[model samples]
Target: MHRFKTLIIEDEPAIRKELEWMVTQKEELALTAVADSVAKALDLLAQTTPDLVLMDIQLEDGTAFDILHHHPSPAFRIIFITAYDHYAIRAIRYGALDYLLKPIDQQDFNGAIERLKKQEVAGLPGRLDIARQMAIPEKAVDMNAQICIAATDCLQMIRLADVMHLSGEGAYTKIFLQQGKRITASKPLKYYEELLPGENFIRPHQSYIVNRQYIDKYLKSGILVMRDQTEIPVATRRKEFIINCLTTLK
Candidate 1:
């Protein structure tokens, strides 16, 4: 019986140990390398070409996306491990990639491993591209990065810099982009609030989240004047928080 050479990339000490133990339990798997940060992971990758990579989404230095970006076409299969990051998990699922949430369940881990053993590496690059585009970084929010938006007819990839504002309409979100382009996303405003980088985006009202870069001015009468000339109301409770965020930007 041939054992699959596996590489573990995780930062948390407890989880890392648990994963190592779990991998040891699997007779088909052989733990080849373990890395706690992006730098170490990269160094290990340069040295070893493992059959499978168990990667955590966020590391001390950077994200798993950074690692993926570095190696655009990796030979090994990947099973992403992350916390309850709605956007990251959603992106992985959207890409049809395997992911195990934190506090890893034994059954789920077994299932993901079984699936990986059965599947082929065909179309991995395309799936990875989709995952990279849609996965949001937990620490650094890059304004220039592109995010995948699920529209009614199709999935649209929109750059974070091009987004002007987001408005909530019941369960859906209406994304206002540059040059008067708008897209109705299947997800709600709260989903975007969590996904978007807080440094560039702010929730001035429950119904609206505006990009700080596109704000023309803040009115004294509890309103925001956008560069596109759209007036968005400010919630009474969020007024102080919004003002503080804007002040820091200036």
Candidate 2:
């Protein structure tokens, strides 16, 4: 088995250590080098070409884009690690790049690794345009226009408007779409929560996130009925927030 040659670029010591340990845990991933600054990252990249790079967007001297700028067309794949910045996330989404929000979950990290493996096998193209768009975001791809779902067989891109809701299935997720199409993805629901536009989707329960556009009505029994007549239970704790979201939409 060929393990992925990986590089870690993070400034914070604690995060770097955490990520280092995490990388070590994955037998299929081999840690090639570690860099704490953009200059160090660039220097290391020049010396060797790793199959994958886990990069932090915020560096001491420069951002992850600085490293990307140094190598316009890089051979390796990139998975951006960023703090919660809505604008930056929008750019990443439009650029069609994968990202993990701060306070990273282990499962999410593993999911990203799995995604990188798929991208590598499929020779996924770089989304350097997303980094550029973060600076001058003009003519960005519409957020609600489409969504990419990782199916059992492959990555499937479908219209966001067609999705009715998402159901959590432990490590996987079941996406309910229009025309009664249901696809199972190899990632958790939290992954979609971060990827999807906030305005379009809302989590009514720990197990369910329903699209606002597909909401038929909120039943008195504390269930949300989707356009496809699927009854999604509303968590008692999330009921108020869900009501507010529904009210705001109206």
Off by over 4 Å in 1: 1-81, 85-100, 103-140
In terms of lDDT, the poorest run of 10 residues in model 2 is: 121-130
Our model 2 lands, by Cα RMSD against the true structure, at 5.1
lDDT per residue for candidate 1 within 45-163, as digits (tens), equals 99998999999998999999899888888889999999988778767854557889999999999999998887667767767886776665453555676666767655576788999
- lDDT by residue (98-202, candidate 2, tens digit) is 888887779999999887776743423334654455434354445445555557886676777788899999999999888989999888988788767677789
Q: Which candidate is the best by lDDT?
A: 1
Each prediction's TM-score versus the true structure: 0.58, 0.65
In model 1, what lDDT does residue 196 have? 74
- The CA lDDT at 187 in model 1 is 79
RMSD after CA superposition, every candidate: 6.9, 5.1
lDDT at position 197, candidate 1: 68
